[model samples]
Target: MDIDLNTLRASIDAEVNRREFERLPARDDDSLPAAGLIDSVAAFEPIDLEGYLPEPPEEHQHIEPELVAELLPEGRFYNWLKRPPFARHLQRPRIYSLLTRASRLPGGARLSNFIYIMARGIAYRIPALARLLEQSKQWRYLPGRLAGFEYQANQGLYAHALAVQRNERYLLDRLQRLEQRLREQQAQAARTAGAPAAEAASPPAAMPADLYVDFEAHFRGSREEIRQRLAANIPRFKAVAALFSEPVLDLGCGRGEWLQLLQESGIAAVGVDSNPSMVQCCLDAGLQASVGDGLAYLQGLPDHSLAGLTAFHVIEHVPLDVLVRLIDEARRVVRPGGIVLFETPNPENLIVGACNFYTDPTHRNPLPPALVAFLLEARGFIRVEIERRHPADPKLLLQGQDDGLVQPLNRLLFGPQDYAAIGHAP
Candidate 1:
């Protein structure tokens, strides 16, 4: 199919313009500058949205009334689990319930625990109450669910006590073993100063690159699904096609989805990944890929040797130090005018930042658009623009939001779930 890059770009821009802070002052607007990087600000820092107010209520529209307290956002609750006391608890419902009951024992099962268990079982297992609970979102907030504030608060204390007990046992075991090993090693080192005592100074072992591959299908999606997803961003790829006269290098090419898109479009590209399984899968698909650390591969390349580079959904897995290094390496290896793109989950979207981002335990942090733009500029990447992708359906966004709060609420709740930071090497 012939690509209309302009039209696709316009479609993407239109969605962004609609959902972003356009009505607010330019300083608070969502669109970022492309010619230079935005200023370095922490991704999690509070933005200056001080004066931006929700629009006036619409006179003609009315939303179905569910009591205010019944609306429990799933993503918000997942982030709450990241807190100190709550974080320590066993996330499993059955385990938490068992532990809670055991903790209350004087000599036998406590009445509160018995009641809670029996009630939960009867409510969920019986046809009548089970159906009622199935119908009501509020029931999910019951004990062990969201509404168990007091129960969960007590669970926090129980979790802390258990954690302390386990940690003490582990520490005692490790310390005794460590002391013995250290004394033996110290004696050996003293006896062999000239015999090379460098074992203790060796760098830590490499993390198993395939550590999270088992969860890839859940988080990264199937190859066909990923390709269909990329199909929505044809303009983004078209921009890539226009900029590169040579093969593009795809970093962390999980499942070779983008590589497949590029090759099918007759665009030349090579994929690199640390996961051996991913690399082999790419090869089996008849796409070019290599197994190695992405940063190390970039560092090994000759200066200004490539025409373009892309790292989709890769940066979030890297430490900030290595992320900067990757940017620097890209600047060094890709020739002038070569395009550099990094697509990540858009944390500005509350649901994505708070919920989906955590599904991939490999993700280090969500890079806000401003911080990424700033980093690219810091490494001399120019024309750093961001494009929001995969917005929620307009119909869904409009429902119950006939009030002027639609746009503001959409920006807060239903904005694009992903973004691509595009720039060119200077």
Candidate 2:
């Protein structure tokens, strides 16, 4: 391998100039004193420049006159002692670079500054430490410098160790709790698994075939709550009334709130609810209502007989296939020019969608505005317009606070879930 002596000389000169030392002498060490160049020259020895400086093996080949002068020189003395070539000459510049880079030293300190600087420099510049030490060739000065660096670096190292220990303790505690829970769940699951098989072997409980068969049982308790809300909506039901001049069907109409409004507005309105309790309550209130399934009642209506239809918060609980069928039913009943004014809870309200939404065991899902609009439009309903009512309750502010950024971002990007769709059959 051939080493580029000219390039090696150029790099050595560059290193020396970086330390503000004089240019390389053309002659050898026989003439001048090599004072400041030792630190710079020694620093370059550890770097494997074989790829750059490939040369053949010979006694004269590896030896640079400048490097030789810097290393194995004859008699050179600085102050009170004689200086050997490779012994130790940590000139002021290397000392300054070490201390200033670590931001530890001030100007005009004693020569002992090199001791602290070397310790920290080694820690600060790890793999570079060996290279720098080889370049400085000042390893012969004090072996204690290595130990000092280990001590300095250990300060932060111990703090990290304590934090890791605390994290391990926390994880172990959580793991133990999880293991206990798994054991309990396994035992409980074994017991319940047996019970299900026993029940399956026994005579099965009779189930209601149609939803209307047991609808009254669920509504008996919530009858007053439904009736009160329905009664309150009596006057504000003008939206559906204004949509049609012909007959209208009100779906899931508990106690006929909109029917009363339609009657007062002088528009024909009919109420069909599956809950017998709710139907009786509507009759007691002197409003026209009947105990029957909404889908069946809507389907039974003569084609093109109705002018409008309105279903509020009722679509979400309806299955998707059932919903499409209901849309077909709505299309069948309403005349070509009539409108369907439908409302459902918006899924965009995070508290409602994520938490309160599931409280009603019967609710299938919250119907989003886009989904409702798309289904209605696809089923031959034209001129569909969506509107959002009922801002989320102030109680949901706590949940909404964390999801504030998320809610608006989704609304901007995907549109809202809880809204109303008013579409015509045109």
Q: Which candidate achieves the best TM-score against the true structure?
A: 1
| Model 1 lDDT tens row, 1-426 | 344667666765665555443333365656755444433232223434333444444322332223111321223433353355654443444534443454354533344544566687768878988888777756555645745677787899999999999999899767754653464354346445643221111011243435555567766667677788777545655666687676789998877888888888777889888777778888999999987778667756776777788887888887786687677777778887778888899999998899988887667789999999998875667789998987765676745636786777888678898898988876
Report the alpha-carbon TM-score of model 1 versus the true structure.
Answer: 0.49
140: Cα error in model 2, Å? 99
Q: Write the per-residue lDDT of candidate 2 for residues 304-407, one digit (tens) a residue.
A: 78878888667876678668767776876788787787777677766667866675556767777798899887766778988875554444333346586856
Model 1 C-alpha RMSD vs. true structure (Å) is 41.3
Give the Cα lDDT of each candidate.
0.68, 0.60
Top candidate on lDDT is: 1
TM-score for each model: 0.49, 0.42
